[model samples]
Target: MRRKVYTKDQILKAAYEVVENEGFSGFTARNIAKKMGISTQPIYLEFKNMSDLKNALLDEICNHLYYDIFPEVRTGDTIIDLGLSYVYFAKEQSNLYNALYVQEYGGGKKMHDFSYNYFHQLIVKHPKYSKLSENKINALHVGTWIVVTGIATLMSSGIIEPTQDEIVHLIDRTINTVLQEDDTSVLDSL
Candidate 1:
């Protein structure tokens, strides 16, 4: 008997549903197959193994993370708005955000590089940053990422239950600190 073929996208859609409903803990080949309404063998036929399917899911997640959030980073806009949007995206897609960054997965390359490169590029685009050293820009990027990630984890773990207003204010402080520091420098040096 010929094996039935499933499209790669079909498997990804099913996998996303599995992630949404069951999370990483509850998803498995059986679950996906049930969701797809087909035998698991078709998944095996389409993908070499569960890892292949998962890597594809990660790719889609990466795309969603980048595409959905990139508009805020682009537009040559103010950095403060960009920082706030980051938190908003994290809050809105908490599940997908945790899945992309918090979950353990096989392909280390995609896990580490795909999302980060865009983040690095975004930091380089900051308007006030052109006058700063590369090290300073890199530090700002890393620090901003740390702030958002820490807040997301804290919110998810229930460690720091910040109101939405508090989160907005905190993000505003982080972004405002950059210019405040720049503006507060010794004016006599100019």
Candidate 2:
């Protein structure tokens, strides 16, 4: 019998499946090998080490979020749509969401940077937010991100099952509160 060789991409896909199904805790070379029905030698041969494989997996997860998850939301408003996509991802891919957000797994900064930059771009382009200073826009993004993340965490853990309408209401209220606070801060400063 001849030995089967796995490409890096194949190994990465197996690793992703392991994490998606079993969360980060199951992200081991042995587990990946088991999933692929091969020995761990293939994984070690394709990647330098588990850390390297995990970093690659993080990129894979980010790509999945960017392509598979984020693009599915289209509510005519980019910012709100992003929030909805996040919540939807949490609900649909709870294990992946927890691995990235709750467990960190070296993905927290990547997710934060991606979300903040994306939100900033949308806010800068929005008619309502375009006039706001960059500082104010950043504040608004952070504030809204906190609320959205909290809701997503709760939803992913099955602690709270809010309807889409409820999520929209909560997100809208958070955005409004942030803007209102910024306005009041300006008034107080005046």
If scored against the real structure, what TM-score would every candidate get?
Answer: 0.72, 0.85
The clash count of every prediction, one per candidate, is 0, 0
Best by lDDT: 2
| Model 1 C-alpha lDDT per residue in residues 1-190, reported as the tens digit of each score | 9855788899889989888665676568899999989988878888899887887788787777677765563334444445556556656666665666677743245755764576556656665555665545545555565677788777766577776567666655665564455533332132
lDDT of 1 at 38: 91
Q: What would the per-residue lDDT of candidate 2 be over residues 1-190, giving only the tens digit for each residue?
A: 9978799999999988988888788989999999999999989998999999988888777777777777565666667788999988888888888877778453678777877777887778779778887666776777667778899989988899898888888888877776777444532331
Evaluate model 2: give its lDDT: 0.80
Q: Give the Cα-based TM-score of candidate 2 against the true structure.
A: 0.85
RMSD of each: 6.0, 3.6
Candidate 2 residue-wise lDDT at 19: 86
For residue 11, model 1's alpha carbon misses the true position, in angstroms, by 0.8
Q: How many clashing residue pairs are found in candidate 1? A: 0
What TM-score does prediction 1 earn? 0.72
